[model samples]
Target: MIIFFFLQSKIFIACVLMNLLIALCCFHFC
Candidate 1:
């Protein structure tokens, strides 16, 4: 259970970082 939660949190953080990167790219180009 703890291992599963850790993986989930890692995925969540990755998703957030991806979204932030996309937003930065849009702001720079558009």
Candidate 2:
């Protein structure tokens, strides 16, 4: 249970970071 929760949180953080990175790249290009 603890490992599952930790993995889920890590994935959520990674997704958020990825989204921010993509948004920044798009804004920079456009």
Candidate 3:
């Protein structure tokens, strides 16, 4: 159960970070 939560949060954080990075890159180019 603890490990599942840890992985879930990590994945969520990673997704958010990647989303932000993609938005920033698009904004910079456009």
Candidate 4:
């Protein structure tokens, strides 16, 4: 149970980081 939650949080953090990176790239390019 704890391991499942840990993995979920890790995935969520990764997704947020990716989104922020994409936004930054768009802002810089446009």
Candidate 5:
């Protein structure tokens, strides 16, 4: 159970980072 929650949080963070990167790219390019 603890391991599953850890993995879920890791994935959530990765998704948030990806979104931030995309937004930054868009803001810089457009």
Candidate 6:
């Protein structure tokens, strides 16, 4: 149970980081 929750949070962080990166790229290029 603990491992499952940890993995979920890790994935959420990764997704947020990815979104930030994408937004920065769009802002710089467009």
Model 4, CA-based lDDT: 1.00
TM-score of every prediction relative to native: 0.96, 0.89, 0.93, 0.97, 0.97, 0.93
**Model 6 pairs whose backbones collide:** none
Clashing residue pairs in candidate 3, if any? none
Which runs of model 3 end up more than 4 angstroms from their true locations? none
Compared with the true structure, all predictions reach lDDT values of: 1.00, 1.00, 1.00, 1.00, 1.00, 1.00
Q: Name model 1 segments beyond 4 Å from true.
A: none
Per-residue alpha-carbon lDDT of model 6 for 1-30, expressed as tens digits? 999999999999999999999999999999
lDDT, candidate 2, 1-30, per-residue tens: 999999999999999999999999999999
Error of 4 at 12 (Å): 0.1
Candidate 6's C-alpha runs over 4 A off are: none
Task: Give the CA lDDT, 0 to 100, for residue 9 in model 3.
Answer: 100
State the weakest 10-residue window (summed lDDT) of model 6. 1-10
lDDT of 4 by residue, 1-30 (tens): 999999999999999999999999999999
Please report how far candidate 6 places residue 6 from its true position, in Å: 0.2
Measured by TM-score, how close is model 4 to the native structure?
0.97
Estimate, for each residue in 1-30, the C-alpha lDDT of model 5 and write its tens digit. Answer: 999999999999999999999999999999
Over 1-30, each residue of candidate 1 has an lDDT whose tens digit, in order, gives 999999999999999999999999999999
